[model samples]
Target: MEIEPYVDTTLDEPLVPEPPEPGSILSESVIDELNMTVWTLSNGVTVWLKPTDFKEDEIALQATSPGGWSNSSLEDHQSAVIAAGLVQQGGVGAFSTIDLQKALAGKAVQVSPSIDQNTEGMSGSASPEDLETMLQLVWLYFTSPRQDETAFQAFMAQGRAVLENLGSNPMAAFADTFSVTMAQGHPRSRPLSVAILDEIDLETGVDFYRERFADASDFTFVFVGAIDLDIMRPLAEQYLGSLPRIERVDSHVDLDIDPPDAHIQKTVRAGVEPQSQTIMAFSGPFDYTAQNRVGMRVMAQALEIRLRERMREDLGGTYGVGVTGGYEQIPEESYTVTVAFGSDPLRSEELRGVVFEELRKLQVEGPSQEDVDKVVEGERRARETNVRLNPYWAAQLIGAKASGQDPRFLLDTTTIDAVTIESIQEDARRYLNEDRVVIVTLLPAEMIGRP
Candidate 1:
């Protein structure tokens, strides 16, 4: 007997026509019609709600607090991290870790907490039906955290174990070592040192959670899904409204450490791999800056094109290359462009010279119209694809509004179409000059020959 494949020849209804081209300057009336809705809760927590009538069953909610390692006292920075790790582990209100797990097990509710250079945070998801339970758990986790001493000690031990493992891991060690060589004395350079574990104690964890984490004014709640604003409004008031008042809020500090015009090369052993690559990182402009803002983005994309063409395609020096610019809100928001790849042990300096040559060319002649048009078209296609693929893109718009950006900026083409060849040249001239580049090469100990 022969089996045949079956085809369902059904055709779906067409979608509404795509919006008009966003090339020209966007007007206030056009911006006003953009569908990003935001409101402040009675508890002083700003909430951005985006209603998406997508077909997906699950929704993602990301709520972030503004102060991470940068704002905390160096001693207390890791403490902030410690508190975040134990958020769900130490139990909230009457729910132990096991109990919380059991309550949401089959329902697909997840709560995770993390801390970074700029913010300490918790965010997770629940089914649309469990939104109330999700918010309640988050509120209790933030407000009535137990910070059990045993759990804190266990986590500290785990952190120390992880650091010891990093000593044997080349990639992990590169990040820490290169970060120190790049930013040096700035707050941005501060890594989670192994010594941070020694400094951990029960009292410190409790203090960081109670004195630092409990402040609701510093926190924001973001809910995105098939949400009913009327239903969630009362739930927000009942759960989040009761958080302790924090009159004083944590503020951002700048980490603008412009490195000197020198090449720094170093070598170390990671007890594992004998070979690894180095990363050359340079600071660029923040997203909200004047011409420098979007200019830096175009510049980074242009550099990626050059790097891919010269380093990968032409010379075959490395497997891949990437350049990106993003707004990292604090130690004060700034832009960074990093180029990284594994190197042949002997060709490390040669690779460095090639990189400098490409950057120099960019600074001098500037990119061609063909190059500019390629990136503009690529960026446009990527954005359109992302907007169509992810329903959460709408939620991202709302989150950006809550984070204090004009939501219409996403819909505006001025950022991309306006990125002219001259603009890219100007930004490269400003930020990627000889004095601004910090070249960090991590080679094997034996390969550390003079440049």
Candidate 2:
């Protein structure tokens, strides 16, 4: 029997479906269990501990150092971030990565580093039996960061390989272009450039670790889960107390947020996926504002719904669309709403226009009662769910308190219950003005150098 030939016609069919957005109405009981304890060490290390009363076989630990790109040079910041990846690769004191692995072998201890634009730190989890060794490892990375040049170059080479392959990824290109356009000339603007990577000589790595990167004064230690203040205090005093007090350099540069004179389209074509991406950035007020934060949360939820309905359901553009606010605390605190969607380059202009029109509608006419209620309900549910799923929510709250932001915002029933619809409309009116927005379009490189 001969099988019939098949012709693929699915491409011509509309792909996205209009599904009811999940959990539109939030419940109240999820908000009750938010609790935490904060302990301040004599040496200035703030610790946040939240115990799991039911008793898990293992424990997780996480600590964050708040001073990120705002506190260091682009090159040094990159070096410090990248160094976190390389720290265990070399070794500390007398141990190599291999030796350290062998030491922790068969034990429930694991350590890793996480670096971000505004923070750099390490985290680990261990069995109650191995907590001391876990903390010791943490101390090693913070105190003696072994910046071996050979290992760093090898790591950089691997990074270059990954970057070269990212040439084809539409999302990666969008991210690259967005960083350049939004943060140009600012410390936040700089990504690891080829030129900078090329200049990473042996001395660069050594000086980065020994001098500017891991200063004790810029560090904050946070421990969560099954920790005793008395037992850990001496260990902390010994491991962390020895850190020298040194004045570190600050990395801040001035940049403007006003919309560009003309809308611009940029491209990075040398990649595997030659698709186009659009990034819609609108002015958002500083995040610390109670009104703005509440407004921003509601507005973001409203925008997410708008994008889902308009782009995914109405236009059938892509599988997903995301909108997030870029809230920075240093290098001058500011805010921006970045929305990106995946699509063909030919439709880039249409996508941009539709997004702007949506923004205009929000500015000219306030969201409907239904839209406002839906967002408020969605955000309230989200905040409540987070408090329940992660016990570390308490640590995060306490950390915010340690940094001077009131943690009460999380637990304050008055604050959560008091978010008014008028407050949402007021923020939209104040910050969503088109004059303050920047529209950036990034397309494939082949499509570029043509128009």
Over the full model, what C-alpha lDDT does candidate 1 score relative to the true structure? 0.63
Q: Give all TM-scores, in the order shown.
A: 0.80, 0.76
Residues 1-451, model 2: lDDT tens digits: 9998995332221111221111111111211343444544443455555555433545566666555433445556455545455565666645555556666668888877555445555667776777767766666665555655566667778868876767556666557666666654455455555655564444444444444335554455555556554665555555555444455544333334233433445555544444666667765347564555566767766767787789789998766788875555544456777677877777777777777777667766767778887877776788776654333563565356434676556565455455555565566666565666566566655764347
After superposition, candidate 2 runs with Cα above 4 Å error: 1-42, 52-55, 58-60, 64-81, 113-120, 166-174, 185-193, 212-219, 241-275, 284-287, 389-391, 398-403, 444-451
TM-score of 2: 0.76
* Cα error of candidate 2 at position 142, Å: 2.9
lDDT of each: 0.63, 0.58
For model 2, how many clashes? 5
The alpha-carbon deviation from the true structure for residue 326 of candidate 1, after best TM-score superposition, in angstroms, is: 3.9
lDDT of candidate 1 at residue 234, scale 0 to 100: 65
